[model samples]
Target: METLTNLESFVRSAESGSFSAAARRLALTPAAVSRNVAMLERNLGVRLFQRSTRKLTLTEAGESFLAAVGGNLESLQNAIAAVSADDGQPAGVLKISVAPSFGIGYLLPLLPEFLQRYPRVRPEWHFENRTVDLIAEGYDAAIGGGFELASGVVARTLAPLHVIAFASPAYLARHTLPADPSGLIDLDCIVMRSLSSGRIRTWNMRNAQGDEVIATMRETVVVNDPTAVREAARLGLGVAMLAVPDVLPELESGELVRVLPRWWADAGALSLYYPSRQLMPGKTRSFIDFVVEAFQREDYARRFAGSLG
Candidate 1:
């Protein structure tokens, strides 16, 4: 009989269409997933996947094998995982991805209490600006706005993603504050280059009464990251459009002030993305619940809203 590990590797590789992706889902290396698949193929005496540089395709026999075992395999694995979880504490390497500014500013502070409560769980965090493939990259969870919800994933919203124009008091002293979104074009504006699209990011600003305008500002400085943009604004380089969470500290400190207080952009919601609930491990579930509860208790949803500007 084929070992459950080998069968799982084969199935996940087939589903994800790559050993690397399967490795992430299985918490193993790509080589380990490949080796397991190879062993399974050797045992079955048939090739399961057509290997390639860019993509993996299932062979005829591989497709047949997958159809035969996929459903049963998942049911068995779920049963095994459920039993194991019931018997043990939530303990494992919990891998997550988030934006550096938000992770450090907000989520990092929550780490100590979380660790104290769940000492057996280890956190491996990746702080980056771009959206990651949760299944392909093997993240336990990701927190951010504007992620394309791929197959087998679900998102729980934590807060509104509200983009508002801001600038230092020094910069405001040199230039008149914009009366509306239209006047923003006259000011020196620091803009962000979208990491995924490699283009200047723009947003449509709206007021509570439903007045809408596209914020087309003259880019005096361009940056790819949110933190850098905030710093540039702090240095009196130019007015910058940033999320409320990104500028809350500066705003509170009287370093940064809102430009168009009534006008802001609705970018989307900052969300926590993960694989489906049924397939989630104990650690990931615990982390998700903890984060969601924390966000609620802190009322981050209201605090992060640009409409409050």
Candidate 2:
């Protein structure tokens, strides 16, 4: 029987495609992971990885071995952990990925309460805009919109990711308010560039009658981050289309006012995604329950509906 540590290192290294990346996820050094793999290979009398200066590729034996062991590794670990845990308490590092603006504006405030409730579970969160490979990166969960679902992953809708147009009072004072989406072409619109596509994102707006129109605007300032676009609008730079949740504080506090109240961009839902394991980790299950309950208690879905009342 192989040592559990050696098996874990092999599985992670194969999934991540590099010892360094596996090291980061496993909380070990690259050299340590490499040595573990080497020892495992020597014991088995077969080379597991085709090593090169730039990359590591799995050999035929490695691929077959991974096919047999990779799927069961997490379950085995979780089972052992469950047995060892005190009274089934959720105890482990719960790693998650989230967008920066949403994580800071919404999720960060809820962490204190979550921590207080589950003291044994430590949260490791990454605030980024890019979609992450959950299984390969060993993330427990991710929260965002429009992520392409990987195999063995499932999602639960948290709230609708609605976007609406807003501008500072001073900006509207300087420029004429557009009567409809078509009139937006004449104003200086602060737009965000798509991180994945590397193109200036076009505005998708819908009327009360559910008629959709793609609006093109004259760009005054182009930013990559959603928070930056909100700040630009707040500084009276130009009108901007931003997520309702992101600018909720500013909108409520009178720092920004609605431009076209009837029109909004229905992108998708903000969702919590995780691997579809038969036996989920206690920490992950608890977090899902906590977040769902919190959303219900706060009525976040209705509050973030992107409607001007």
Candidate 3:
């Protein structure tokens, strides 16, 4: 007899069309997924996927099995989620993703308190300069930038992350501040690579008519790490752009100077985003509340200083 859960693995592989992608979806290792599928095939006395060096395709049995079992597997998952949602107090692990600078500059301090508040809640926080495909990666929730997202995902705004341009005082003294916003183009700049979209990050500038234009700079340096980009700016290497709250300390200390006072870009928020499943795991709900409540508390906001957003 074959386990239904093993069959579920086979189904996931078929849906994603790649074992590695399915592994990410299931939060399992690719080898484990392959083993489950192999075990299922042996038990059923039929081959499932036709494998080759570059690709794998479902065999006749796999296609029929999916047609029979896919809906049932989805229902089973929904039932589990329904049961998990009723817990009075959330327990177990919550896997969350967030931007690197936001984690270090803001969230890290609150973590001590959050963990203490709910001893049973274990959080696995992934702090990177990249965005994870939440459903594919099996993340419970993520704090992300920008506004638009897939319709099936839910987003709750935590706070605003105002963006601004700043350069080290020394760099400004040498280059002479751009005559206007457009003049920054002529000078050297450090480009921040967008992890989620893979598009070259550009400053979105708006004219008086409210039309936005992307300002592309000649990149003198390309860096993925947020801290490294700020460091580059700090050392007078070039003008670097970052969230406003991130460089406030440097601004106050006269280490970095805000380039233009009037123009600013909004990062919208560091939001709590999750899938639109009918029943969210209790841990997922708990974390969203915790983050939202934490941001609302006056003391908590003060603690982060300017990085509250």
Candidate 4:
């Protein structure tokens, strides 16, 4: 019988398309992964991969082998983990990626409760604005708005990421508030430069009357992050377009007030994404359920919908 470690190395290398990538996911050296796969091929007496400098392509035998074992590898690992643990408790590191603003303003508050309930689970989270490769990078999950769906991953919507214009009371007191999207052309607007596109984003806004307009504001301050834009607006720098979830506390505390209240930009849905598998890790499953329950309990979808009063 082939050793489980060798089988794991072979399967991961095949799935990731390169031994180096598989090594990263498995926390092993590239040489070690390659050796294990080489040993496996020697034992089986069949060449599984067509090796090339650019990419690793699976041979017919390798494809057949993967089809036979790939579907069951996760189940086998979960079974081993359950039998090895003391009580099958959800105990492990849960790595996640989230946007800085949402992570600080919303998810941070719920961490204490999650930790209290699952004492054995530790969270390793990254606050980033860009989308990450969940499987390649070995992330358990991620939270963000409008990420493209990757293979073997699924997303669950938590809330609508709606953005509206906001300005500090002091700034509005001195400058005239915009009555509509067109009026924004005369105001000093704080805008965010898209990191992926390398361009200043244009605002696509809609009113209650179903009229939509694409407005380009006079940029006074250009930033790369939403948090910086919110801070600039709060400092009375200029008007900013921000998500309701990011500015909810400031809006409630009277630090910032809504401008052009009738109009908001429909960005997309904020979602929690994870690898779609038949047998998920205990820690990952627990975190997913806990977060979903938390969102439902808070009624976050409607509360942060960015609708005007």
| Worst window of 10 by summed lDDT in candidate 4 | 80-89
Estimate, for each residue in 1-309, the C-alpha lDDT of model 1 and write its tens digit.
Answer: 999999999899998999988998777899999999999999999999999999999999999999999988978867765764676577778999999999999999999999998888999998988798887777889999888999888999999999999999998999877778989899999999988789998889999989999999898899999999999999999899989999988998999989989999998899999988475677888899999999999988998988976
Residue-level lDDT tens digits of model 3 in 168-212? 878888877764457778878887886666676776754344555
The residue-level lDDT of candidate 2 at 200 comes to: 91
Q: How does each model score on lDDT?
A: 0.90, 0.89, 0.74, 0.87
Worst 10 residues of 3 by lDDT: 300-309
User: Residue by residue across 1-309, what tens digits does model 4's lDDT show?
Assistant: 898888899899998899999987765689999999999999999999999989999999999999998877888887866543436578877889999999988898999999998898988888999998888877889999877888999999999988889999999999887677889889898999999998998878998888898766888999999999999999999899888998988988999999988889998999999988656777888889998999999989887888654
TM-score-based ranking = 2, 1, 4, 3
Runs of candidate 2 exceeding 4 Å displacement = 15-17, 24-28, 39-50, 55-75, 81-86
List the RMSD of every prediction in angstroms.
2.5, 2.6, 4.4, 3.4
Error of 1 at 65 (Å): 3.4
How well does candidate 3 match the true structure, expressed as C-alpha RMSD?
4.4
Clashing pairs in 1: none
Give all TM-scores, in the order shown: 0.89, 0.89, 0.76, 0.84
Whole-model lDDT, model 3:
0.74
